[model samples]
Target: MYQRILVPVDDSDTSRQALLEATRFCHNQHGKIRLAHVINLAQFTWGGAEFVDVGELQGNLRQSGRTVLEKAAALMQENGVEAETTLIEIWGGTISSAIIEDATNWPADIVVMGSHGWTGLDHLLLGSVAEGVVRHAPVPVLIIPIKRKK
Candidate 1:
């Protein structure tokens, strides 16, 4: 029985699906959930230089991450599952690395997350975070793939 389930969320349909799946799993196992959202401030930095005062941008990103975490936590609560939320700031690493580190440090039994399922040129350009987590996570990771609605 996977008791401690860690879920990483973003503002995406796939993430929503992941949350739903995590909630269902917890409900069945009587487990707890740790919801996390990572804010990658480095994305705002362009060309390896500080182009602007990123303090405000970083603050905004933090707020957004909090919002994402809150919404995920709420979903868990609404499903009658215990949930703890964390907002991770990626000051010096990739988002996937932050998520993997959090999962190891939190010592979760399993990780549930969403996969954008990018392929071909898009996959090469965007580089899948789910792929990174699958490759490096300390625990078993369940990836829920989401398809775009046409």
Candidate 2:
């Protein structure tokens, strides 16, 4: 029985599945759902560019994050889950840290996320975001792997 279930989503199918699962669990248990999307600041890396203004990048990323969260919210609504969505676009931080911070601050009862993202080689080189979150998250985390067509 979860009170506040938090699901971190992106523009990926696996993330969408995580949302579906979280919503189903919350709906059955009469719990509230929190849909969260963290726009990683490192996504705009320009290979040692000197004039990287943190403020400008954060502004752009914030808008993008909001757009992503809006779609997730729409999906939740379609599934009959009235979720309270949160868009956190922090500057100069790791995705795992951003997620962990939100989970701690929001005090979510559970965290559900996709096992991996769109990053292919990068994930292999730098490890997976879901893995990182699970390693550092203070609360319970459930990782759902992206379903690939056979």
By TM-score, the best candidate is 1
Candidate 1, residues 13-96: lDDT per residue as tens digits?
999999989988878576878999888787778664466677788888888888888888887788778789998887667889
Off by over 4 Å in 1: 45-51, 147-150
CA lDDT of each prediction against the hidden true structure: 0.88, 0.83
Worst 10 residues of 2 by lDDT: 41-50
Query: What lDDT would candidate 2 get against the real structure?
Result: 0.83
Candidate 1 lDDT score relative to the true structure: 0.88
Clash number for every model? 0, 0
Q: Write down the RMSD of all candidates, one decimal each.
A: 2.0, 3.0
TM-score of each: 0.90, 0.83
